[model samples]
Target: MPFVYMLQCADGSYYTGSTIDLERRLSEHQFGQGAVYTRDRRPVALVWHAEFDRIDEAFGWEKRIQGWSRAKKRLLIEGRYAELAGWSARQRACRERDG
Candidate 1:
């Protein structure tokens, strides 16, 4: 199975990626040998993850999640579906008002 994952960096920021080997990938991230973004932010912890049968599906969701707002991402990491909906609503309202 392919996995889509979110990592909470030591600096409290988040990173999203997809991989077929979650354990190995996470080990690399923790050891500062992962993506350049996570390399400097070593010792990251997995905050959220989902498994998919297809690499393409996992990769697509990884891309989509990376584009999300920080607040929404946090809601997802924390499994706060209610807060995510509210955040989405607020974002839409602000965009409509400004645009």
Candidate 2:
């Protein structure tokens, strides 16, 4: 199975990725061999993960989550699906206003 996963880094930032083997990928991240973003952060913890039947599905999900705001990602990690729409709308509104 393929999986989309999120790691909470030591600096309170998040990293999102997809992998066929979650454990091995996570181990690599821990050892500073995973991602450049995560390598500097160090000491990351698996905060969220979802399994998919296909690697492409997992990769797609990873891309989507990578674009989310920290608050939105937190809501996802906490399983607060109800608030996601509101947060997403707020984010969009902010982006539109800023631009």
Candidate 3:
């Protein structure tokens, strides 16, 4: 199964990715053989992940999650799906109010 995963780096930043082999990908990231972003922020820990039927689906989810706010991602990582839409609504309102 392909998966979309999020890792919390040692610096407290998040890295999102999609891979068919979750364990191998994580190992690569740990050893600095993964994405440069993860390489720079080594000693990452897997925080959230969802299995998908296809690679493209996982990749699509990866891209979407990568664009989310830290707060939104936190909601996800914490398994608070009910609050996600509310957070998005709040964010949209903030953007519109600021502009």
lDDT of 1 by residue, 1-99 (tens): 899999999899999999999999999999988899999887899999999999999999999999888989988988887766646657789978999
Question: Model 3 Cα displacement at 8 (Å)?
Answer: 0.4
lDDT of each: 0.91, 0.94, 0.93
Model 1 lDDT-worst window of ten: 82-91
Residue lDDT tens for model 2, 59-90: 99999998888989999999998878857767
Candidate topping TM-score: 3
- Cα displacement (angstroms), candidate 1, residue 48, comes to 0.5
Write model 3 residue lDDT over 1-99, tens digit each, in one string.
Answer: 999999999999999999999999999999999999998898999999999998999999999998889999999999999888857757789978999
Judged by lDDT against the true structure, how good is candidate 1?
0.91
Better of 1 and 3 by lDDT: 3
In the predicted model 2, the residue pairs found to clash are none
Candidate 2 stretches with Cα past 4 Å from truth are 89-99
Model 2 residue 39 lDDT score: 95
Show model 3 residue runs off by greater than 4 Å: 89-99
